[model samples]
Target chain A: MANVSNETRPLSPHLQVYRLPLNAKLSILHRITGVALAFAAILIVWYFLALATGPEYFETASAVLTSWFGILVFTLSTVALWLHFANGVRHLVWDTGSHLGQKASNRSAMIGLAFMVVMTIITLWIAIGG
Target chain B: MRFLTDRKRVEGLGSAKQGTGHFWEQRLSAIALLFLVPLFVLPFAYNLGDGYEEVRAAYAHPVNAVIAIAFFVTVSLHFFQGVQVVIEDYVHGRLGMILIIAMRLLSTLFALIGAYAVIRISLGA
Candidate 1:
């Protein structure tokens, strides 16, 4: 390691320095879905705890969920769920030591996105229709 | 024995004995959740009549009750394993490790209680 200026510390292929490729984008979305899962799980816990407490508590949660803000959170969480679930299947495929090639990987990513849209539409249809 | 010492030399992280059980159980639970998640989500999405009696009736089904318990138990077990790994990476001290262990144990207990509540409510006991 030679003495190098602080600004030139051998760039480690940062995202800002280069365009994000498809595989890279999928990896980023995988991490984001994980964080989203945690947040959604917490909201679930709050709902269950409310249910356990009593009717009044449950009603409060029910009202909040029916509110616009709550609906938005639910919609976002629904999208996150579909995205994560589709990508998770891709991960399961990789776990079995298949689909490591570039073409297969890109195709899987595209399929995952398409599946996410379909699931989101179905989710919203049921959400709004009922 | 000489064989024992040789094995020890090669195996640095001594086997904990229960980790694989935890892993397999978590996986099994996740598979079960594939069905359970949809079952739960559909009812909510439909905005079905959600009176206490209706809720109780839905949960009281043997299939629903059993799956609900399994879902919570497996979810907590998986979360504990994941969070423990995170703590091992970042905590890096005896006290920190102990704190993490305590938190994990507490979380498991909370999950147990929640599961118990679900069972009781479903049974109307």
Candidate 2:
């Protein structure tokens, strides 16, 4: 590809220039939750590796999960879980050719946010001694 | 000097068009995330007793193991695609681009390895 001169080209809607609309915010949240889940991959590896080595190893793994840091990570993972799921459902609805209009788009975004909050609360409840 | 410089430039895409692959993969991962998220969330509600053997057995169950593996794989792939698009849009400088690429590659590899390990342990290997 040829290098184009920035000066000659008309201004484009770059990240800063682009107004963050409902759809845009939801899109960014999806990416953020994705990154969060990527970090949770470490827990998955730890669990599996512990299981492979048997009961003693598994206890060591479980103990870490019960600690403060483990609980924090677990809580974060739950939030990521709900956020991704709710946003994903929104994406699926959009895929079905619905919710493209302004009113419906805002509604979907609100619904997604509400669902994520409710789900996260329920998840944490279950995680912490519920 | 673009197309005139190379015959490869004449081809629109590579040998295979990958639009469908990417689309379906994204959807499949999304669906997996939907179910896996709930299953993972549910397990944390009830405290697993403080017994090593009990906890081990709970995880050793083929179903639990399978679901965990599925969650690991789907979550990782979803993250991989999401981060790639973000990096492509936001990364501009040479150093930034390199960092983005490195991040994506490592994230994918880590996800893949974690998923593989989960499957092996879940299957009782």
Candidate 3:
């Protein structure tokens, strides 16, 4: 708002107004996953808090986390965690002035997607004692 | 235009004076997390269903303790910066400012609590 006018300007096409390409979709997904991970930080913090609080508290937290619902949420969070990390690395690569074109972006998107898929599966497998 | 000395002209990032610094903080933290996440999460993930004593033992290890501390401290900064940008983009006016302030306070508290919890657990105190 600094030094900006209150005059309403022509808005860009609404998100629902048009179908977005994979690039835009992935870009938004990066933000979504980042936000997801932000909230997911709470899960880790709670574990530490419970652990420091004592055995009873730790056991309670552990039980809740290992519950079906908790596992489900954690699984989703893990997906988000991996996607955000992979896509973020893509962004960092772009920041270095490499892969500035759509083709390169698409290639990295494919690579990142593959990495996230494989890693998430392996991680969930190990995590769930599978 | 405001008159600037040579040093200020060259050293200043932009009109707002914070152009690249904020960007750099985000990037640097992302780089740190790039390493720290695997170092921290891979082990923690395996301990997901384990009991309290095992969990405590994991963090009690000095390397794990240090990594946890580093992850929390670094992530507080990253989280604050990331969410602050989101708030700025989506929130506006007085409410936006209020949320940003509140978020800053919360992020600081998060780091403090994380450090405290890890240190206490490490010392078994």
Listed for each candidate, the true contacts retained, as a fraction, are: 0.25, 0.64, 0.61
- Listed in order, the DockQ scores are 0.37, 0.37, 0.53
Task: Rank all candidate structures by their TM-score, best first, as comma-separated numbers.
Answer: 3, 1, 2
Question: Worst lDDT window (10 residues) for model 2 chain B?
Answer: B10-19
What tens digits encode model 3's per-residue C-alpha lDDT throughout A14-55? 877788988888888888888787666777888799999999
Better of 2 and 3 by lDDT: 3
Q: Against the true structure, what is model 3's DockQ?
A: 0.53
Q: Residues B1-125, candidate 1, lDDT per residue (tens digit)?
A: 46577656655343554535555564565566567667766655765225555565666678767766766666566556555655675777797689678868866875776587677766666
- lDDT, candidate 3, B26-99, per-residue tens: 99999999999888877888888788888899999999999999999988998889998999999999999999
In angstroms, give how far residue A118 of model 1 lies from its true place. Answer: 1.4
* Candidates in order, interface RMSD in Å: 3.3, 3.1, 1.6
Best of the candidates, lDDT? 3
In terms of lDDT, the poorest run of 10 residues in model 1 chain B is B10-19
**Predicted structure 3: lDDT:** 0.87
How closely does chain A match the true chain A in each prediction, as TM-score?
Answer: 0.83, 0.78, 0.84
Give the residue spans of candidate 1 off by over 4 A.
Answer: A1-12, B1-30, B47-49, B83-110
Steric clash pairs (candidate 1): none
